[model samples]
Target: MTVNSANARIFGSDADAIYLAPIGTPLPTGIDSVLDPAFEDVGWLHSDGITEAFTGSKTEIRGHQGARVVRTRIETPGTTIGFHALESKAQTKGLRYDEKEVTVANGVRRTRRGAGQKVSARSVVVDVFDADDITVKERHVIERFEIVPDGDRVFTNSDIAGFPFLGEIIGDYITFESSGLATDTVWNVSVTGTPTGGTYALSVNDFSTAPLVYNAAASAVAAALNALAGVTGLSGITATGTSPTVITFPSAVTLAANGSALTGGTDPDAVASTTP
Candidate 1:
């Protein structure tokens, strides 16, 4: 392969997030800004981030002709995810010890470990964000897994308390669903009459574009809208065409009363699935 600098990319792990749901829950078919209510965000994790491990045993077959290995077979395939939680909430404690929290008082909660307690399995979803663009990300789904404590638990005032956890893969190990930038919301702008120079505003957030001439160029209008200040969640907005200039937004937005609303915008679809 030839070396290509354009294809090389570096990533950072700061914006990654993890979510947990009941085992056998249905996976989402499309990517959205917010996840379903069934999945609970795992909150802050250790700075070391999440780690994945694969383990298996292999057997080799030898041929009698030349005393050489001919074939090999893999047995006992396994996969696991390791991570440390920085929060000591009830949900985190429950996952670490396969126990539920029992309320003792208004602000007091406790968890007890008993003999022959079976570990609980959960569906895990890990969302990894792109360093360059946080909107683009990859969602890793594990159908069923058990969370086991990876190290001894020590509570002390001298150091920060961290809970180490290991997720054991049970069945249908992992699936990756990737998404690109969100669809852009569009609108067609039409100017009528002999109106003087003025600014155009969006009805949704009251975001107004810079001053524009009576019949300004589409590119100029796009540049003015893109330069709007104090607006949130309206990135990569653009404008095209001459008379009925079309404006596109990075995400959904409401058009002002003077323009025609742009349509045909949809969120990115999940690229992979493990189950129906």
Candidate 2:
């Protein structure tokens, strides 16, 4: 049996956060854009964690002659998010009581609920943190949803106040966007013959390095390549290994052979995603 630890990933909600905006507010352009000013962070949540529920109904089609179900059809597929806000602020309260009227007088906040009121749809963005608990791993965006209170508010000395609410997806369902991870370009640099002390030049992406000795160490070659000026994309390129020195770039880029001085360069794969 073989085990691969590289495929394992553990995610926690320690640094997770929820953001809410008006229905017409634009969704985040990318995972890094979740912090736009249009969205309001709902603050801390209960340790129970956020729940995403996908529900659907299935119907079986039966034939009278065979008396057996042949096909099954799904119906009313829906999605909802459940969370308990630990903060007792206006944002959470407004979500819980969508029809409540709020006013502030002398720095005193008051909310009043009215009869025969309707809940309004809102755009929600849920940020899930990575194992580091700081970087965003995945961003779940709901274009339009209605916040429905769980109608249960618990206030006790033993536990903190939790304002439970459910987000009923009204328009589009959840669209997931993840942070892009770029793989560095790598090249194997090999020296063919032993040179009796002569200077050689290395060129990468049209940028040439300063004069380097023919018998220079891999580390020295890496330093000379990294020290190349006037090219921003070529910065941070590294080299390692002996004979066939391995070079890596910060991003996918075209590599020049420098008249066969550097060879066997490979570009990183392109990032692609699809919407459901």
Name the candidate that leads on lDDT. 2
- Candidate 1: regions farther than 4 A off: 4-12, 98-101, 115-118, 133-136, 156-159, 173-234, 241-276
Alpha-carbon error at 90 in model 2, in Å? 0.6
Candidate 2 per-residue lDDT, tens place, 139-239, comes to: 77888878877657877898887788887887655555333245666766555544444455666545667766555688898898879763333456677
| C-alpha lDDT values of all predictions | 0.63, 0.66
Give the clashing pairs for model 1: 186-262
lDDT of 1 by residue, 1-276 (tens): 789453333444565778888976776543333445788878888878788888778989999989899999988889888888888887677766645446567777765665433466788888676666555556677788788778766789975588888888887744543334366666766664434444333333454554455466878877777777644335667777755677776765545533222212232111111111
Considering every candidate listed, which one attains the maximal TM-score? 1
What TM-score would every model get versus the actual structure?
0.63, 0.60
Give the true-structure RMSD of model 2. 11.5
